[model samples]
Target: MTSPPLSDLTVVKRAGRIAAVQASVALALVLLVVGGVVFAVYLRAQNRQIGAELRTLAMTADDANDPPPDMELALRENNGHISTSDGGEPGVPLLTGATGFSDIHANGREYRTLVVDRPEGRVVAMTDLAPYHAGRNRLLMALGFAELAGILASIAVVVLLSRRSVRPLANALALQRRFVADASHELRAPLTVLHTRAQMLAHRVGTADVRTLQKDADALVADTRALGDIVDDLLASATMAARKQARDRVDLSAVAMSVRDSMASYAHSIGVTVNLECESADGTAGFDVIGSAAALRRALTALVDNALGHVHHGGTVELRVRRDGAKVTATVADDGVGIDPDAMATLFTRFSHGAEHTTREGREPYGIGLALVREIADAHGGDIAVASKPGEGATFTLTLPAAPPA
Candidate 1:
């Protein structure tokens, strides 16, 4: 079955997250700036109105002996004593400015005062700002609530809109998953039948007198087995793709040793030696990582199997697990004919022609095993690296983050 396009889902989700964050930050900045500007304008206008009223009162006190009603006014003679105005002390300190306004605190109250200089003396007209200040404070409180509500509303809208916009992508991902599952299910039965038939024919041919037919049957069996392996790899890939994040404390040393031991018989049959190497910092046999045990075992098995299949009859494949600070690494090295630099470039890619370089007699490299290993590593939030020389050997290393200490 062909691989469906599920990668687009990841791209869409990542891009959506970035865009939503940027939009939210931009919206917050815009609201804050606009609210600040409006508040500043209101404050300036309030100041202008109070100043104009105070100025009128000051001018009225300059023309007459009486002050405007409900307004506090003071007049000083040339010697700076209150002459005539609102009843006050005989010597009142009046501000010197003629047409300017200043704020003052008097009698536990805030006031805006305008000073005017007349031909006789100076006149001071004052108005309390406490009421205006209270109103402004209330307005600011309302605006603060409004700004907060707006930010929350914008976040809600962004979340809802982002989800709505990605509906099509989500649908596409669902369809792809279904397609892959169905296709793998459908192919499973036919591949099983073919393998059974090939095995039956090979068995029947073993008793035939025609030697040529026997040889042809052996080849047929090998090819059919290889095809079955390919199908199995495809099904495994599909299964892995469908799995969700399931992180647990996985013992890398155990997984590596288990994979090495499991592949021992196969390596012996192919005239290759498989070895396991593991060590802890304090000389223990445990190296912990955050991942699924089954998945890690499968990935290590694939690497070991790949290495064994490529090495020659007397070649050695070593599986090593080691812990380095906050990371654990599992490495598979084979002293077989090494990989070409050209082929090594695309070695881990799925179905790449470069991965099918060499194989043992009964084992064929389908170019899918390494790809599956890489996928498994990535799913566990790990990474794989390869190093090889044309004639020396190749090494595959899988690195995973160490689990936090218990």
Candidate 2:
């Protein structure tokens, strides 16, 4: 079992979301600053215009009898009597004691008032601010709507750009993971073979038989070449898309034999027996499928390795291949402490391991091997299944559609 790590795509997606939020905040701040500046300018202009109108009306108006629209004129006679154009509109307040502009709020209305002293008396000019205030309110509402719309548009643009920017990185991360997984899955058995053979060579080096030494040296060289071939295959596979890779007819029996041969030394070292059996309904010699040979071999190797891990020292692990109708099935069966019933559901899930099972090396399975096997099966238009009972052995069957007859 291979240990699962958090997916690279998931991490990238999180980063993209964070980027979008940050971008949105910055955009919102920009819109706020622009809106604030526009509103402030509008307020200053409105105040200046109102002040000019009040000054002109107070200086030029002859009497309170007739005044400009929206403006009210008040006259205080030398006799201490007051007169207004609106018959003393309640909304206007008299401020003859003050001789400067002032904001007056009365009778639930706003007015800008200007008071000036003259020879006859004092002149007070008042203008209603309702229209100006209404205009300001409308501008504020427009700014609010624009700000909201701008922020929403910024978020949408940021999200789209982030996804585009993150795509290449996501693909690179995926490729890296695939390379590591493929290399790790393919190299396990070969590395074990090399280790076992090296130990045998070291033991035989002190022997007097020259032929045995030569034989061990040759075996080591052959295993090293095989390891190199596996590395080359992994590199090629990693560079190409799985669906785009060339698929040829691969003999399942031959693949099982290869697994048996590769695991032979490791199995011997652990006192376990590796066996292979091939059967066909039509009495054919080979159970063939159309797929990547390296991928299929790795799938079979994972199964064999998993079987070897759980089986006892003297237990037997079998690789069985058979053709039924248009399907080719490869089953790896081992007689050892079986899988826990509770752990069966997640057996194929990445990073999921049985707490009760450990390999012959006394290490916990990494939990990804079987997951990779399931993926490989799916890539080749196939599927895998498992059966086990507590204290009994487990059997994994990998089923793939058989290649058409040539």
Backbone clash count for every predicted candidate, in the order shown? 0, 6
Clashing pairs in model 2?
1-366, 1-367, 2-366, 2-367, 2-368, 3-366
TM-scores of the models, in the given order? 0.51, 0.53
List all candidate RMSDs to the true structure.
12.5, 10.8
lDDT of 1 by residue, 84-103 (tens): 44533221455444456677
Off by over 4 Å in 1: 1-225, 353-356, 362-364
Pairs of colliding residues, candidate 1:
none
- Top candidate on TM-score is 2
Whole-structure CA lDDT of model 2: 0.83
Q: Which stretches of candidate 2 lie over 4 Å from their true place?
A: 1-5, 77-82, 87-95, 225-406
- In candidate 2, how many clashes are counted? 6
- lDDT (10s digit) by residue, model 2, range 167-218: 9999989878876875577578778988998998898787749998898897
